[model samples]
Target: MNRYDNERLSAIAVLESLRAGVPTRASTKALPDLRPNLLEIFKEDLKIFAGGQNLPGKFVWGKYGQGKTHVLASIEHLALDMGFAVSRVSLSREVSCHNLFHFYSKVAVPLRTPNSTVFGLQRLINQKTEYELLNSPIQNEGRYVHPLPALIFEDYFRTEGEEQDTLYGYLMGNPPSDFKSLHKKARGEKPILKLERKFKPSEHATAF
Candidate 1:
């Protein structure tokens, strides 16, 4: 197929996947050029993130059919290209903003990275070194202690055996009730329960 035809087919496939309630593999290439203003804003925000600066969250607000999802997918693709991990979650009744635990779980479930488009968190946990993973938390305890992302990292690296399964269960909204029990089962006494228990139920319920 010609380039245009190929792009058309790719867009169709993405729409089909969305209709099927499956994750779409849409990339920035599939999207038309964003408006110049939007593009500039995206670049500026991306530069901040790439520079290791904390940028406040930007919300995309539009009615249905205004290309919100497409814009988000494009941003996600660009973030991955820029070596940043991305996760996209659509809020529904089941994963509502009113319910923090469910929302957090949904966000973790769809995390994507440059290499892995789905289940990227698992890949990250397995690939990142213990020192690499623990360095920031060790250096700056305030930033990484009780945040949702920190909880995820702590739970995944809490014990050695079946780490992936434990994280998967947490992302799936079925966190362990007791980290002490989990550590005992793994035959490791690392003392993560205190930190784990410090999190609010909305924060650590899935992985606690």
Candidate 2:
């Protein structure tokens, strides 16, 4: 289709979503912000975070039908388009923010990057070499609460096919009982557990 045709289709899609009482990333982009001040503040906060500064995060509060979710959806899309990795989850009976490890599993598995609709970091992981993987900041202790994810990340690089997928799944929060066998096949050296600190879910959720 022509450029104009594509734009028209996208506009139609945005309108359809809005008509259904849901605003998506396309809808956010097409419509003018109802609360520019709030959005601008968030954009600035994102900029600060991107500059290597940590933020405690911001809270957006509004009564029902006030578009709080819409604003957050917009920010999620904006951050992804800016080349940032974004994971979004809503709290429910099954997924509560109070449980750190469970919450991490929910968010980590749905990881999204700028260009792909598929979740997880498989493509990015495959692009790196062993040297790059080992030297990356994640391998350093004190950066995160635990070094287990970093070790699994390195293991992810050493295996391929189903074994690689298993390790990747572990990194995404689904640990398999037979993972040690896979690691042995890939590295043929010391056990992976021996190479890193023991992971305690209570104390190590932050690492992933």
Candidate 3:
């Protein structure tokens, strides 16, 4: 279909989402801005983040039934359109951000990039070579306090099927398993993975 056709369909979808009281990316994008100043602030933050600078976290506070979630949905769509990955999650009894790794797990699995409908970064990671990953910013630039995540990420590329799935799940804050055994399955001939340091839950909460 043409560009106009796509926009027309998206508009319809946005209307439906709004009608249901569920604000989505499409609705966020097509509708008129409710708070342009706040949006500009978020846009500037996103621009800086895209430039590889660390941005302090933002808090959105509101009373019940306010449009806080709706604003976040708008930001999600805006970030996606800017070629940034987005993950929008809600807190509930089952999910709490009090535990950093637990929060990481919740966000990691739902990762959404600008170009793909599929969730997670597996496809993107699968496209990279060892050399590329080894020298990548997350690994070499001191993004995380612990190397465990980068190591598991490296191994994720090495293994296949269930092993790979497990590694991905491990990153997503699932229960720990015999990673050594799992690594052996992936790299039988290679030496077992070694930790440069122990992973302490309290200290390593922000590793994601």
lDDT of 2 by residue, 1-208 (tens): 4456887889989989987877887899989888898888888888999999999867889999888788988999889877899998877989887878788778888889888878878887787887886678887777877877777777777888888888888888878899778777777876444744678888888787
lDDT of each: 0.63, 0.82, 0.81
Off by over 4 Å in 2: 1-4, 190-193
Sort the candidates on TM-score, descending order: 2, 3, 1
lDDT of 1 by residue, 9-69 (tens): 8878877765764434463465456565775688789988788788887888899777677
In candidate 3, the residue pairs with backbone N, CA or C atoms under 3 Å apart (3 or more residues apart, or in different chains) clash, namely: none
Which candidate gets the maximum lDDT versus the true structure?
A: 2
Across 103-179, the per-residue lDDT of candidate 3 in tens digits comes to 78888899999988899987877788666766776675366788777777777888889888888788767745688
lDDT of 2: 0.82
Tell how far residue 181 is off in model 2, in angstroms.
Answer: 1.4
Q: Write down the TM-score of every candidate.
A: 0.64, 0.86, 0.81
Worst 10 residues of 1 by lDDT: 187-196
C-alpha RMSD between model 3 and the true structure: 3.7
Number of clashing residue pairs, candidate 3? 0
> How does residue 166 of candidate 2 score in lDDT?
87
Candidate 2: lDDT of 67? Answer: 82
